[model samples]
Target: MPPRTPAAGSRLMQIGEAAERIGLSIRTIRHYEEAGLIVPSARSEGGFRLYTEPDLERLAVVKRMKPLGFTLDEMRDLLAVLDALATADDEERRTLLDRLGMFHAAAATRVAALRDQLAVAEEFAGTLRARLDHHGSCTT
Candidate 1:
């Protein structure tokens, strides 16, 4: 097995460094806050948002979900499910797994829809290429 990467240190990092670590712009992080995906652990004396290790991990989850076409609400629901799982007893763990299965089914539906849309786009591109080739022949 590969060695584990150290989690972000528990100390608060300035927004720039945290953003760099997470591969997002500070503005995007702020937008995520506005969207209710993450809340900073605390504010500095200067009133800047201060993030801790948990926040960084949460941001990583958000980043992963966004590219997978999860809406902010879906991401929040998934996070809530994960958070509940973390604190769950053995019986609750079973419930959480059931809930997660539902979430996965919904995500798969979304992925299928996206795939259909992409196939349409590919077909359009092929038609466009044929049209361009025909026009090129006429121009020549």
Candidate 2:
């Protein structure tokens, strides 16, 4: 037989494998699909979502952005804007940049919110530790 193509050697992953590979629940993957963050390139013969490496990479982006406080809608919007810019002509670059500015502003806002939450959580943790230490001294 002739040499096999990479595509033949590495077929698309099923929903379960995709989830496991990305350390996300299958439901989470489905939810991302619903949110338009990731779309499977195709379906398997059994009608299961067939995720390729690009899909997995996309999920990685989604995962990274989420813990950093990006909403699914934001992620979706960002990706859509990126795809548009990437496919746009030079004349359209300016327009795309203007759109990208909106996403950047939103991301900045979310990051600020996360930072505030972190500050509050750190303060609360310190207070709790102080209380625990005080109780320990009283009980000793």
Among the numbered candidates, top lDDT falls to 1
lDDT of 2 at 102: 81
Tens-digit lDDT string for candidate 2 (1-140): 11112365456778999999999999999888877788787776888888878678878878878877777778887777776786898878888899899877877887899899999999999999999999999998
In angstroms, give how far residue 96 of model 2 lies from its true place: 1.5
Which regions of candidate 1 deviate over 4 angstroms? 1-11, 20-23, 64-71
Look at candidate 1 and give me any clashing residue pairs.
none
Q: After best superposition, candidate 2 residue 87: deviation in angstroms? A: 1.5
Evaluate model 2: give its TM-score.
0.78
Error of 2 at 62 (Å): 3.1
Clashes of 1: 0
Q: After superposition, how far is residue 107 of candidate 2 from its true place, in Å?
A: 1.2
lDDT of each: 0.84, 0.80
lDDT score of residue 132 within candidate 1: 100
**Per-residue lDDT of 37 in model 1:** 80
Per-residue alpha-carbon lDDT of candidate 1 for residues 1-140, written as tens digits (9 for 90 to 100): 11123345558877888899999999999998888888887677999888777788999999987866888888888888888898899999999999899888977887888899999999999999999999999998
Count steric clashes of candidate 2: 0
